[model samples]
Target: MGSELEMGKRPPENAGNTTQVQNTPPNTHILGSVSTQTVDLFNPPSNACCFCWCCCCSCSCLTVRSAKDKRILMTVSEKQEDVDTNKMPQLTLEEVHAWGESFERLIKSAQGRVHFRQFLKTEFSEENLMFWLNCEDLKKETNKTMVEQTVKQIYEDYVSVLSPKEVSLDSRVREVINRNMLEPSSCTFDEAQQQIYTLMQRDSYPRYMNSSMYADLIQSFEQLNES
Candidate 1:
């Protein structure tokens, strides 16, 4: 009974004052050292945090869980072109070995094409392979209308000097392409294709043979075969 009476008693500081206490909201309570009202956990104010019921005015309790891992994120360089290199088809040991036999063999295989394309990318001449690939696709099209459209698109993408993906071509080849543009056909890019093919075979293919990407792939497959 004495403890209950002590709890109900007011502080002695306001004993002789004429102040009258007005009734406030029933559940609101002053919290923290600075007398800020505690926020409702269910519907906290915008300035307050939902994870904690304490007012942001004076509360200093920890609010969030500590981070568990610090991962080193790999950044893509600005020079990296957006090329799709996924979904590589399964390759046989013989097929992979054949890529080393000749540049002609590598460009003909689907598996070899992607790997070689990537290798050319490192040399900053992937555009040459892309132009070659586009021309090959253009050759397959029998529709005259589509042949015209694709030839024009390929010219804009690779043959034109204005194109960012333009491949290096001699003036003679460029002049032939300019004349061919008047009556666009599947064979419009044949000369340019031959030039790029020779360029890749002579320059890019040899380096690609000794490239780490090719070496690692062959080593991995060889290791797999042994086991």
Candidate 2:
């Protein structure tokens, strides 16, 4: 009973205030006067690392998977062993004495080869003996593919000028290797092997014979035998 009022839809309480329509995307909600973003932890962004919760950079988990792919892509035969050693069996007095008789005898003995290699290392000529040993292993290969791979590895290690362990070889032997490279067989390195063998026999073998390394081994063996 104040004055007669117009009978119409009542004005919204907020009519006096500006009604703002928030342009929020889907899955968003307004709570009170604050807007908070919610993330679907189940579906993270592309750059996010699943391995580490806080890490966003390219991570080791992804790199390890890539390494696994590379390993799988390589043939089992072509892959080198991750760990290897040149260790030989324990030496014996008989083996030590035989080393003095002839270079061939020394080369045939595992223990002798180990000691001789140590001697050659001091002379910076170990590659000659290493080349000879690799050829021995190469000659044992029956598979054509294995022969080819082994040949290439030996060439890279001992025949190539770029190699730190490149062995000495005459022009004739080198030319022969270059010529036979196209169709390699187990005996592809025979000439190179023989050249290195002869080189070791003539030069390094005598020096190794006179070295205290050989003398000490012989003395230790004799002493051990006496004990």
Candidate 3:
């Protein structure tokens, strides 16, 4: 009988072909093709096409951005609604009586401020009170840009000699303000505000307290209260 190996195995003539097939891995071509096509998932290409896809086509990212925009729009809309709803409160009889009791008390109230402004308008010295009120409002502003704008506005309206609405301020105070304007601040008009405050306190307050307008307003308040 033939040898067991010789009977079971292929002949030497085909052995070379069989060996060559066995030495090559089953997925060798697949691995070579895959390596050439391999993508780096962690470090994507920084092309405009990819960027556009990320910004426009990525649903999760777009959703987050759109939600942020909606929130901003909603906030602005709510602020506008609040401003629209904020009408001035009406003056009441008790408020009028409290205001009548003292000049200090009168200037503190919004209603009293309005009435006092009207009184000042008649006196032709309304700019003084207006400037003081503007300064007060300016002090309340927290934004630097807005503060700067307000300072400029106040300077033009009340400090400039050429302005018809210029408030009466001494040369020393004007000089100080001019220097302060170089580095404008919320308190740029502080000295001027104090001067005007004193002017109103000394000159306008007593006269306003004793004026026919005051008497008439008091009478009106009483009638309104009685009714």
Q: Global lDDT of each model?
A: 0.57, 0.57, 0.55
Among all candidates shown, the one with the greatest lDDT: 1
Top candidate when judged by TM-score against the true structure: 2
lDDT of 1 by residue, 119-196 (tens): 655555677778888788778889775676466557656765556666778788888987887778889889989988
All candidates: CA RMSD (Å): 33.7, 35.6, 41.3
Q: Give Cα distance to truth, residue 99, candidate 3, Å.
A: 2.0
lDDT digits (tens) for residues 1-227 of candidate 3: 13211112122332111101112333222111211112111111111121232122333433333344344333321221121111435455567678767777888876577667656655666667777877887788787766665565566556765466667777788888878877778898898889878878877777767666566666644543454
Query: What's model 3's lDDT at 100?
Result: 64
Each candidate's clash count: 0, 0, 0
User: Which of 1 and 3 is the better model by TM-score?
Assistant: 1
TM-scores for all candidates? 0.61, 0.61, 0.59
**Which of 1 and 2 is ahead in TM-score?**
2
Models sorted by lDDT, best on top? 1, 2, 3
TM-score of 1: 0.61
